[model samples]
Target: MLKNAALQYYHTVCSPNISSLLELRQSRKSNFEGREHQKYMLVKWNEISPNTILKKIESNDVELALSTLVINLRNIRMNLSPEFHAEKILYAKLLQACRTHPAWTIACSTINEEDTAALINSLRSNVATWKAQNKPTIEQFPRRDLDDSEILFIDPRYFNSNSN
Candidate 1:
C-alpha cells in the first residue's frame, strides 16, 4: 500500500510542476569541476516545456551552454561507478570513456570473463531501466524474434497495411 501510494504520488504530483533543479545544478557543477567530465542534464533541453529553462541558457547563464553540457556529460560518463551492479548506462559510459582514454581501455580489457559477465548483466539491466523510465508505454519482452544480425530501426516503410 505504501509503495502504491508513493508511485501514485510520483506519477501525478511530482511528475509535472517540479523539475530537479538541484540535481541539474549538482550534475552541472560536478561536470564543471573536472576538465575530463562529461555533460549531464537530467531534463533534456527540447523536452523542457517551451519557455521555462531554455530561456536561462539563451540569456547567457553561460553555464547552460552546449560546451558546458558536453563537459558534464563526459564527467558523468567517466565517474560512473555504481554501488549496485544493475546499471547499464554506467557500463556504457565507462566503455565510452575508456574508448577515449587508452589507459582506461587497457584496464577494462584486462578484466577476467567472470567480472565482465557481471558488468554486462548490470549494464543490460540499466538499459531496461532507461527504456521503462523514458518510454512507459513500450512493452519489453524477455525474448526477441530478431537475431543479432537482423536488427533494424523502425521506419514507416517497414509497415504493411494488410500484413501482420
Candidate 2:
C-alpha cells in the first residue's frame, strides 16, 4: 500500500534527524507589493521562550520584573477571544516561564490552579520574602560634635617678623 510505504519512509528516513515539525505555507496575499499596512504579529509563528524573561529576573533578582510578564499573558489571554485551546496553551507556557524563577520553585511544582493570578501571587509572595530578607535598614552612627576652635585659630608665629 502507498500509505505503508510513506509511513516506513517517514520512520526510517525522516524521524531521526528532525526534532520538530517545520510547517511551510505560502501567503495568498504575497501578491501585494507593499506590506506596510499589515500588522506584524509576534506569537503567530514565533514562540516566546521562558529563557528570555528568566535571564532578566536572574540578573536583577527583582520579583516586580515578573509583573510585566503576567500582564502580557493576561492581555494575550483576553485577546485570544474564544479559543480555549490557545488559552490553555498560553497558560502552559506561562507556567513554564514561572518555573525559571528561583523563588517560584514550590509554586511551579504544584499544579493547583492553572491561571495567571495564582502564578502572579506566588511571584509576589516570593518577592515579599526577598524584600523582607534584604530590607534596607539605615545604619546609625554615633554623632560627635566637630571641634572648630583649632581650625579658627591663626598661628601667632605668622604675625611675628624676624626682620623687615
Candidate 3:
C-alpha cells in the first residue's frame, strides 16, 4: 500500500515535471552530447517513464526497474540547470519523501553499487568541466566604485608604522 502511494506520487507528479525539463534540455545544445556515457544515460532516462515502470512491474522485476528509475531520476536532477532551482528543491523534497518509504530500500538493493559510483563520478566530472568552461569572466563581474579610480585602495591602517 505504501509502495503504491510512492509510485503514484512519482507517476502523477515527479515524472511529468522531470520529463518536461529533460525534453527542454534535450532540445538545446547540452554538455551531455559530448560524452557517450552521458548520452546513453540521457536516452535511458527518456525511455523509462513511469508508464514504462508499470509495464516492467508485470514482468516481476519491479525492484530492479524501480532502482533504475530512481538512479536515472537522480542523474536528471544533477544535470538540471540552475534556472530550475525551485523545481530542483521540490524534486529533492519529493525524492526524500520517496526515500523515507520502506519500499525504497528494497528497490535500492537491486542496484549495483560499483555502477552507481561510476555513474555518479562521471556526472560530477561532466558538471565540473561544464562549470569550468562556462564560468563568468572577470569582465562580466559588476565593477565597484574603487575599480573605476586609479588611486590605491589599500586600508588606512597599513600606513600606521607607529602602532607596531
Candidate 4:
C-alpha cells in the first residue's frame, strides 16, 4: 500500500503536465530592475527588527542573521538620510558581532568566525569604495566670457541711465 501511494505521488508530481510547476517557478522570478529590487528588499528588511537579529546572535544563530545584516548594510550604505545612516551603522556593528561570536559548531552551521570576519571586511571595503566613488564634488563656478560684467546683479537704474 505504501509503495503504491509513493508511486502515485511521484507520478502526479512528475507528470507530463508540468506547466503548472514551470509557471510557479517563473512567477517567483523578480520583474523589478536592480534598484527597484534593492528597494523592495529594503522594505522587507524593515519589517524585521534589529532586536530580532540581536536575539539570534545571542542564541548563537549567527549564520542566519549574518547574511541579513550584511545585505541590509549594503542596501542602506547608498542612502544619505540620517535614519538610513543610523541603520547602516547598526547593521555593520551587528555584522561585526557575528564575526567575533563563537562558532555555533553545529552540523548545519556552514560558516566559521574567520570566514564571517573576512566577509565583513570585504563588505566594509566595498562600501568605502562605493562611497568614495559616489562622493559629491564641489560645484565649480561658471566660466565668464571676456565681455561679461563682474557684477552679478545689475541695477535697473544703471540700464536706464537718463532716469534720475
Best by the lDDT measure: 2
- lDDT tens per residue, model 1, 70-148: 3444444444333213445434444443333222333445445434345444434443454455555645655668787
lDDT of 3 by residue, 1-164 (tens): 32665566556655566557576455333423335545565565456554466566665343454455556566665555444235444343333333433434333333344354443343334434545655677676777675456667778777767767
Best by TM-score: 2
If the candidates were sorted by their lDDT against the true structure, best first, what order would they fall in? 2, 4, 3, 1
TM-score of each: 0.21, 0.43, 0.25, 0.23
lDDT of 2 at 133: 67
The alpha-carbon lDDT assigned to residue 13 of candidate 4 equals: 51
Better of 2 and 3 by lDDT: 2
Q: Cα lDDT of model 2 overall? A: 0.55
User: Please, what is the whole-model Cα lDDT of each candidate in the order they appear?
Assistant: 0.43, 0.55, 0.48, 0.49
Q: Between 1 and 2, whose lDDT is larger?
A: 2
What does candidate 2's lDDT look like per residue over 1-164, in tens digits? Answer: 32675566556755665554451112212311123212222352124434454565675545545765665565544434245336566667667776766666566776588775676676678667766766877659856677776456668777777785
Comparing 1 and 3 on TM-score, the stronger one? 3
Give the TM-score ranking, best first.
2, 3, 4, 1
The worst-scoring run of ten residues by lDDT in candidate 2 lies at 24-33
| TM match of model 4 to true structure | 0.23
